[model samples]
Target chain A: MPSAPSDSLRLRVDVPDRVAPGDPVPITFRVHNVTDRTLTLYLMGRDIAFDVVVERTDGATVWRRLEGEVVQAILRLESLTPGEALVLEATWDQQSGAGSPVAPGEYRVRAELLTEGDPLLSPAAPLRIAPR
Target chain B: MKSMALSVRLLTAATVLVLAACQDAPQPLAPEVSAASVGADRASDALREVMALDRTVFGGQDAAGQLVIGVENAGVASGVRNVMERFGIAPSGYRIEITEPIHFATETLRTVHRPTRGGIQIHFSNYLCTLGFNVDHAGGRSFITNSHCTAQQGSIDGVAYYQPTSSTDPNPIAHEADDPAYFKGGECSRGKVCRYSDAARALYQTGIDSNAEIAKTTKGVNSGDLAVNGAFEVTSQDNSSTTFSGTVNKVGRTTGWTAGNVTDSCVTVNVSGSNIQLLCQTLVENASTQIVGSGDSGSPVFTTDGTNANLIGILWGGNSSGTLFVFSPFKAIQDELGTLNALTDGTGTGGSDGGGDGGGDCTPRGNSGNCH
Candidate 1:
């Protein structure tokens, strides 16, 4: 079903503020239904509907969760009642899509829900990868 | 006097021997550095040098959480030599591999009821979806639909299924029986929830009439309504391997009967805007036509041999353009829900009543004989 509005759903991304080089970074994403009625949402198939992207301070994309992965061509319908939320978690071994480690520096991580119409984007959460 | 002199000499000799033993005693060894500590130190220094060399350089740890780094393949030799010479590190001191650079890319049914077979409107709390097919579960008649069609997923008796687009019906035709809970870890991708099928079963009330058939359209493959032109009896199911491919058909509430080619089999799909992911799902494509749409979430997918239909899966969702659709194979449903005795050979408890054409009286037709 087509979405009602972008405001009816909220997306949030969470990660540690700082981590030592070579440390595994745990990421958490939450999609909450903020509407009073149940909302049927079209989500990408595969286990990932949203993406957690890590970018350098200058806005160069360093790593993304959905990049380079083969996701099926199916849209899924998920209904969320009012006040319900889904928590998605992934641990980044600090490796980029190329299987290389991200350089230690100031970076930001954000999440995006691939919804119909405009995708809902969360604010960039600051992340600093410092040398241990 | 001679005896005293001999005793003093003996005592002096014993004292001399004791002094010699004390002088020969081993001293504590100096503190030594372990090979592991030295290697670790070198690895740390190498990591610092590598990160300083290029900001775009990706560095991280392996599954063992040990510090490791990846440099461009073309520069691996020089990079290794630079770190070794600069940090006095050996090749075994740290882990490294050739890695390419990462580039960012643009990311990319209805109801029904019963004596009621499949392809009819089914309702639950302000929503409409198609009933996929009817089955016999534990000696009782039941119907299947998408888990999202119910008020709650993964809960037994969580929602009631009704017919003809009404939740205010005096009695519900069926109550939810089983919709397996989504799981994480193991085979599921990191951070995503997964389920083998987007299917749920609803047990029919004691007197509700149903058959093991799906609605067929006489209008055309792509045209029809809630009206039933005929019925497709399910004779068997597709149990092929993960690469199974074929042209499949389905009848849903919004879009009646439509056919498409199986383009993908047993692929992991991420449901957009949700954390749930369906694993090993079938994808069908009809580039020339839109086969499924909203309110058609639970349509039964099958293939017919002119006389009987072979069950394949249940339509859950598709691409927004409707060109691509996905279904959960019956094999997956059975694997999760155990045995679901779907009526084949045209045998059912209430007997076939040819089913109604949306405009007919759908009152419980109790054993009123076969309507085939």
Candidate 2:
């Protein structure tokens, strides 16, 4: 008989209460493995290549994946075993690469957790940033 | 008949000449009427000058006779003896009547009314509430008073008030680069930035003790008596101490210098006004020390010991109990003023505990134990 799959792959993200333009918005996520099996996960988002987010709270969803070249060597997290947790952090610069500056407003951040070979999106939590 | 007529004409001519001589010789001025009129005129003039003095000189009309006069610019008190000499009043000839230093009773009344150059009405609230005199220290940058009396942040003509607090390292905060020009004798305080009108300056000048000459003559002030260096005078001695025990003889700008007694010694008074709160301790057994009400925060406390009186404390604040009061020691005040270099000698050194000039030399008048 094959062993039962673990349902413990949980994800969490944290954001600041308020942010102003040109200010970095730091986003951190923690993934925990509840089962005895190993897990692999990847974090993807638009223009989200830095250790922190410095974007305006404009109502745009231009999600961009962060790359090693853009985030330097500071953007990597290895795999984790059962009963273990993997932490990944990134900074989103609002003024990076001369994109349209984000306007001041409330913003919601979405963090999706996935398992290797699995296409299902894990639980998502919403983080709100008040206008500065 | 012709000879007699000539003689009569000569007599008449002689009479006319005598009358002319009398008129030209300045007829001996009538002694009583002229003397009375001159005295009345002099008295009138003195009264007018006194009236013209700033009403705040000693807290208003209550201090009419108590306001000391000096020869300096105006508000400065030359010396007790010198003041007496100016009025032809002799300290030796008359008995000394030491009274409690004048203090205003409330902060609301301490506010001064003045007109600015711009024809704008500027209300000086914080500084006005804490105006009073004491020997200064602080390289002329600081003076001594109840720490609570000093504002955490004060302003004069929109300039930030500067003071040294334990929280600020290197102490004695300075104004910003764009701050307004510094005001000198026109207005001053240890705790807050006080403003003065032209009349206020004249009032201060009338009572200033710049040379410390009066300090030399002061006697019988105790270790913790409140002292000020501004306009004040000692008038007639009221033999009836019991009748006026708790009543203030002099009046000033705030509550009219009414009399009160040290209700408690070493009492603590907690004061809250203008969004500021502070606790101050009056002298030991100072229940009779004229615990300050509101505007009286900066009034000086003195005692009559010998031929002259001496300063003891600077009105600061009170404790929660309201029974206890607080004041700054004259010596400490002098040290602060000295730090400001405001003293004439530019010496930031603190004065002797004995009223800064051998004053406060009297034994406690009554057997009141620790009047707190």
Candidate 3:
């Protein structure tokens, strides 16, 4: 994923409001270029610029998609035309960062576009992990 | 951190405008011309002189989207014409107005719970600012921020500091502890209050948790109560005025985390409003867009080596055009506070904690707590 000036871009995070225990939670991050002209963005290469983090209700982070993964050091420029939307998808297996099964509870999921400037952030979407 | 004495003297725009505006001339439409479009050779020279007078003076635009040069008073209004005439610039091409002095006075994606650290938003009275770094002060917990953000800029008035924003009033997390007074005369020129840095330290209330680690990205939602993802560790510092040329990252509340290059180091900035002048300030140009905004003062400035960071300074002011900003280095900050060190990763051991100053005579702590 590529990152640009946050004010010129809009980010949205989509997650299921409720999911049964042990079910794979699919998270979608969509970035739209709302400006009138094409914008050049900084790419961290290899989808490393995008991250999905799930946190407990107390604001404690439980799982982050990029945790412990070595991100490539390469940075390149990519262009996104106006009105175009970029989407990235990831699945959280309901596991904590330490590889333990996450407890059935309420959590919030958010996405980030890590750029050289302030990272463009998406509102945290609420999700409930309950045993059906 | 190496220390260097700054000797550059800069004249304030108010003084120059007063000198140029003494005479009256033909009235011209509020100088509405762009300096960039002011012709080729001669206009460029005039633009250079205008910039040399003061970078902050002629770089902003007014509401109508026209380039505006701010003057100190209506009398100084004619000074704009005088400058245009002296430099052979056409008065028909530019706009000028009698405007008040630019001020660095103003958010929150920086709210956090207990165990606060650097780069988070802090509120006092009706203003907001960023916490520069958590430090070990007098065997207690303290944080660094801009003096202007305090109840008073030149004196410690025991002002209470709230986290996130002013909505959490009456429940202050810290109180003003150390802030050096601004002096006039001697090293400072006449008619101005001078200070080595616009920095002040606040002692955290008892039981208020904190760490030396600065915030970065990885976890958090929008601008509301951002979850901690503190990864920055201050391994070293640059307190010298030898003109730095490298990438520095600023984790400010308004602009979250932004990177830029040091455009000017150890330059003197004459903050116009109250005749206050800051000495040995570092100026940065944002890499892409506007980075600094209101309420971002005291934001942590540092250089990172992938995982670890070298603490640089605290942001204080930006020009009307937010592309450029100014900060005071750690040397000036320490010159006022005396032998301080950044407490990183909750470890009290100076320098070894990877976020503290090693050579200070102050006693280091032992594991302050979880920075994240």
Candidate 4:
């Protein structure tokens, strides 16, 4: 798993506790290179990818953010020196793969960074929506 | 009466608003620092200067997420700032802290002469350091400690080292043995690549019986009876023991035995005026008292499981307030010293235990039982 304080990497993600169905979901991650050498890591649109996953309490995947986007369209690389970190932020328009607003009910959602075939997933946070 | 009650409520609300405004407001948070300046560059610049300074200190991230340099004393602050200016870094970009000055007024742990880890101290011409791992290279028998311990300009051959006498004796048990067969010190663990450490080795006279254990005492700090199981195999294998979190321990001449957490693994630290990068370090902080003291230099750092122990690093120095203690990893010592014959008991062979390099194992000589 891509975790902070791994042999050479520290990946910490921040997910908000609550958000409306139609609002953009903000995702933030902090990546640190804890090794002694310089590191070239994938930033985006490549193997180093993040997924916004929404799942139900029954363990069913309700939605994925990168459902049909090009996985390799905007591949980016970030360089980090030892003890350096990068704070990357992105936002989701609260829409699912089907382009429909998610009906929230304490839905479990998280951010995952796929690195070196390891899925470093953030702790799932609750996205609540009132029946307005 | 209803109108009066309304008026009272309004007055109370107004008073609360006024009081709230009068309260000191917290300053806005600083903007996020860029990754390179705050991360690698700052860390890299912190290494050599800290080590050269010979003051025990570590580089850490401030709340602003920028690299802040911490020193052990005020004397080191100006020297560090001089280095900072070389990098075009402003004074505000760093922090100077004065922790306790280690290697000062000292006390004896136990009477020397035992195969124990404590009570044995290394003495230079005018300085003294606590002895660390009893190691040998090739066939020359020697011991390992911080490079700054024997900062002799030339050969330290035949330099006298000391051990405390007994509990009641005013004199030391062993004093003035100059057998400096070979000595090497490291100012930087890794030059510009990554983190490194400060280490030194001294080969002395043949008769003294030294072991791998640090002097165990029921005296200072985490004072108690303790044993060194073996060196951490970080130079050979990356195990759970070398993680950045969790408890780490050490036994020193000045501080006796104390425990602290492995907070920062990869960081730059200040020693006197020089900076030395540490790939893995444990910030030694005592629970209630000072974790380290003067004459604690070269003390062996270890981790224990109530019975067994694993060697990690050696005592270098610490801050005055005991807020920070810095150590050199066994792996770094091995990297600079080449082959070190670790002294387990008086019977140790002092051969290279593969000193924690890339999943290696210790030789049969390791007395701590497990090598990995």
Candidate 5:
């Protein structure tokens, strides 16, 4: 007998208006359970693959992920029953010294959600920064 | 039998839970519409209805009560066209007219006002929302446009100038200061002095890239330029009222003014062209009814329905597809004029036949012109 689908699984992230170069951008992901059965949820930032690029308003561009380690933090939900929610947090630091200093201007942050053997889900957010 | 019954109950509950979870997630809200995509056919009808409604409610009153001046002569039209063409506005698809003229007299002069040899008009190529105005400050009177319009002092009307500051500053210092960041071309306009307003600074809080999304959502009909003629006056101290929350009727040159509802509080729209990018903000009105079209730039946007129906915004640019357009808040412009110390007591009451100088008084252009 096959098990049923899990409708309780969901994800969300929070972002800010601006960030400085080398500053840490804190991102929070939440998983909620809407079903009655307990679920074993395995969530890892590394499991997802997406492109990240930062550019100035003038067309100059740089690859954000290439300059620094693609840091990942693991989050596990041993058992989440119906109406339960879990939180996962991670920080993306604009690693300095490896690449040119991110110029001052409007920048874009893109994140894609993916699963093994599944199509990718990508959503992008923009942030403005006043360089120090 | 009892144990089997219990097991079956548990399975059923589990199945129900799984099915519920499998249901689709809530969809995100639909993006707003652009003024361009509203379609010419629908916009024309909406414009007619708004005009009819305005006459019935206001008792056949013109925009004069609202302190709007009409630009209607060939000299005015020719001058405006020259300005538009020099700014790279394609003349084939769009029309430019100076429906009014500026009248000045020697008796009204409290201070000697000399016409500077070098006066340049700032142009935003990509973004249609940006507008041009004259700025009066301690140093002198200068033309103003979006910082993104020009990089450094480029010649306009034989005047030498420089990019002073970015419009995004919250508390921008009026006089030019030493900051390489302030002098960048993409961030500042080239003129005698680049200036930004408090409203523009506040608008910068909203993300700029979001403007593209906003424009994509509220498009208007036709791809060419539009013109709007109406006067906007400050009715209250809290210039914050600059963003009026109400239904408004807009009258423009091409698809004469129409009526619509404002949706957002203060929206910043970026109009991008090959040579210029202008960022402007205005009260976002979402009207199930259409009200404006191309060649309506400079149209006045106001509400005749509410007590606050005073002058609110000046039509600058919009997206036809999403039924959304951007205007400069009247308060912002008023405040800019005030900051420059240009609004003289006499100039306030003076009547001129020049563009934007006619104040809010309305005179009919066509014989027995019916507003409706």
Candidate 6:
């Protein structure tokens, strides 16, 4: 069965400014649409072309995660029309590439819609990872 | 070295001029000592320069219409004074307080917080919120934060608060402080943002580790100072408005310890699109950068006499950027929520020691959430 249409279209991301080291942070991606035309977004294993990157103010890439770690199968393709909001969530456990806990500082977390060639990057969200 | 020699000579010349002018006015003391240094037009210009070049200091006008500067100690104070002097501005009628000294390689005071005060973590379900302050209210020991975090619409007594869901030690140090087995008392109330207040009251277990200390240190562990000395009555006693201008430091789960200036005191803010206006907000200027942020609700914003945490307000909400942090007045919380007592105001007893280490089962940094 096909889904219905929406009314508005807007993409937004929600992130926690503070994290307790080992606790995973949940970053929510919301897609709101308000119109008659239907917008299709591909969902590969439930991840809709989502990518979260945590960088220092110097633009140094500290942590990186892509949608569905190495997608194995296609989950479902969804369509968002006018006035409908689509949401997807990803969790980052406050760790770096060295598998070490990221030190406390000001970090910029950016989530993007890279499902297609042209990617829409959300304004970098300021997140602070404080001590437990 | 050359600057000091120049300042001393300049200050001597300026003092003679100011004293001569006031000598005949019957005013023995010069309140505006630095008037001659920077008249009126050059004052603002001098301030902008300090904001841009002075690294160790953050200066602003206090509510009492006085210039206030936050610094690490006397060392930076000399440099700041010299810089201002260069612009022909004397620091008369200016209040220069101290900030945590930046001594080490690390900047974030991650482990530089007191469990019961600012920079604490309180968990309800899977979410975590920062604690505003620990006080004794209504004859019961309680810790406060945003109502949205503790009360959350349908929050009941014993909703439970994990002093922190995370532990610094290998063994967890955070425990359910509100459980019957613990502090056994909790109050959660969710009021409309602007209409009322968004504050929660979580009663503590008698044995729960609690204190009125604020993280005054900008470094690690207890190596720096973080304690609450005195507080202001932002409700009935508004005479201390000047002190509020010095709204400098805040310890939160996310931002650790950040100091800045509160530009606007009373404001009605519409948080997000909630339609509800958050009343009585203390605006932390974007110029001061990120002082509050997500998951920092209920965190305590305060000032320090280098060692004491002078109570200010409890954080509520901010803009999407988290730069425009909004807070509810402490007096408003006392009036609406109805319970609050400082653990060590020479009054109620929540903690045994002042500026001392946190209690048993926890080390200097505190137990990891699992109970060390």
Model 2 misplaced regions, further than 4 Å: A1-132, B1-127, B134-138, B141-230, B233-252, B267-269, B272-280, B283-293, B305-308, B318-326, B331-372
Error of 6 at A113 (Å): 11
lDDT per residue, candidate 5, B167-200, as tens digits? 2222211211111111124343432122222111
I-RMSD for candidate 5: 22.8
Scoring only the A-chain of each prediction against the true A-chain gives TM-scores of: 0.88, 0.55, 0.91, 0.67, 0.49, 0.75
Error of 5 at B230 (Å): 12
Question: Model 2, A33-101: lDDT tens per residue?
Answer: 777777543221111121222322454453332211111000012346887876656566553344655
Q: Against the hidden true structure, what lDDT does model 2 obtain?
A: 0.29
DockQ of model 4, rounded to 2 decimals: 0.01
Every model's DockQ, to 2 decimals? 0.03, 0.01, 0.01, 0.01, 0.02, 0.03
State which candidate, 2 or 6, has the greater TM-score.
6
TM-score of 3: 0.46
Which candidate ranks first by TM-score, i.e. highest?
1
Residue B230, model 4, lDDT: 27
User: Residue by residue across A1-132, what tens digits does model 3's lDDT show?
Assistant: 234568888899999999999999999998889999898775432223467899999999999876633222122245789999888777899999999999999999999875534557899999999977
How should the candidates be ordered by TM-score, best one leading?
A: 1, 3, 6, 4, 5, 2
**B1-372 in candidate 4: lDDT tens per residue?**
001121122112222221123245232222445335544665565645555776745455656656554455555656776777776665545544444433322224423344434325544433445677665565355666654454331123333445542223333223221212111134334222123444555553445566555444533336443222222221121123433557877666445577877666645553321222334555655556556655566777776664445666776656533435777677666665565656444433333322222122111111122211
Whole-model lDDT, model 5: 0.32
lDDT of 3 by residue, B1-372 (tens): 111433222233333433245455455334456556666565656545554553234534445444456554655455555666897767665555444554321122455445677888787754567888888765356788987777756665778888865564457788877666667556665566677777888877777777767777543312223334545776676655435677777777666676778888877776522456677777778645665755567888888875677887888766433466778888888777766678443432222111222122111111121111
Candidate 1, residue B30: the lDDT equals 18
Interface RMSD of 2: 31.6
Considering the two chains of model 1, state its CAPRI-style docking category: incorrect
Fnat values, one per model, are: 0.03, 0.00, 0.00, 0.00, 0.00, 0.00
